[model samples]
Target: MKQKSENQKAFPRFLGILVVASLIGGVLGGLSGVAGYFWEDHTAFGAAFAHLLGAASPWAMAACAAVLLGLGLYQYRKSDTAFHGWDGEDEDVMQRAEERLSWALLLDSLTVIVSFFFFNAGTAKLPQSSDGNTITLLVIFLVVIALATLLQQKTVDLTKKMNPEKRGSVYDMKFQERWWESCDEAERRQIGQASYKAYVTVSRFCPYCWGVLLLGNMVFHYGILPSAVVLVIWAVLSVSYTREAIRLGRRGQKTE
Candidate 1:
């Protein structure tokens, strides 16, 4: 009973973190877009693109913020209901709700990171040519998207292994139900905790890194440090956080 109570408390705290992160991300992203528009060289096609994004940044971020806030509210309401009405009968529903919440966090975090990148690049004064740099940027964008997709697929595969019934196949449901029936409560809780930790760790990583970068950029503008130095720091932090994410993913895999 005490353990269950602790878990309940942990979830709300997590949701609170999610809400705060989302709000911060939206604001920062919008600010970045505006700054980029003003700072970038206007002659290049990239600059024109950035300027257009700057014009739209605030509205785009506002929409994202609304969605994130809505998700947070929905999670809070669901948590309240689960707290008061939870019974063994609704375990599956509770599990699904948690999974959905995790996915929401992941999506929100990615949105923020992408917005930050737009702002970062938009603010930079790239070469005025519509040549190699543009091609390189496009290739990098595609690679990033591909990597994100692969990671998402890996996460989904891990989830399927953890809960076969989660795939919505009737055969898998029956098989997994029987399999899970044989597992002890401790084992089940271990898997759940691992999965939850993995999701939360990944979701928090990007915002934290971007937040640092944003702060560093602010400091740099005051001439307290070189932009190159700030970029180095951002690079180091990003690599470290990425490594941590990989470690968390591996830990989740161990549960399977």
Candidate 2:
């Protein structure tokens, strides 16, 4: 209570600092805008863009795709190695490796989606956004998708061989339910911790994102739909969290 009161006492000082900072920022911004209004050679940005976005984008996409594929292959090999070499003794190590492989598999699925996107975007910078380019990109997309899917399946199968209690089919509609139900108490706790962290992170970010979206709508006339969507999501999350907390409290789930 003393610490809280002390901090509260400093609030006016902090508010004064904030006010000063805002004033200085506004003055600097006004001067910069005035300077920009008279400045020529704005086309210098365009001149630099060809080498940056136009030329570098394709290579960047290729590098990203290669790294994703390489990492997936590396993860597969690591899992395969652990699965093959493990005696019954290294259970903890096996568990750690299994966790890493599981996360890698999840990320590799994202990689396939990105491979599709980056390949498409990279190819779009070509001399022509032609039918042939589209066809090639689609082929690349399918190939990566297949490769990522098969690799994940093989990794999961290897993990299952080592531990038969795991359950989930990729194609199953209720896979999350089955997999979650199959989790041991420790795994469930881990999931709970992960979920709480995600919730907290997003909660912290919502205000900043909301402020930025509002600024975007106000300054750029980007429309209220974008900001409204964010608010709707934030509202849903807030209500669900509050409702769950209240329900749990009522059910006597609170710790003593």
Clashing pairs in 2: none
Give per-residue CA lDDT, model 2, range 72-91, as digits (tens): 77877877787678787978
Candidate-wise lDDT, in order: 0.57, 0.71
lDDT of 1 by residue, 201-226 (tens): 65556556556666545423334344
- Which residue runs does candidate 1 get wrong by more than 4 Å? 1-44, 125-256
* lDDT at position 1, candidate 1: 100
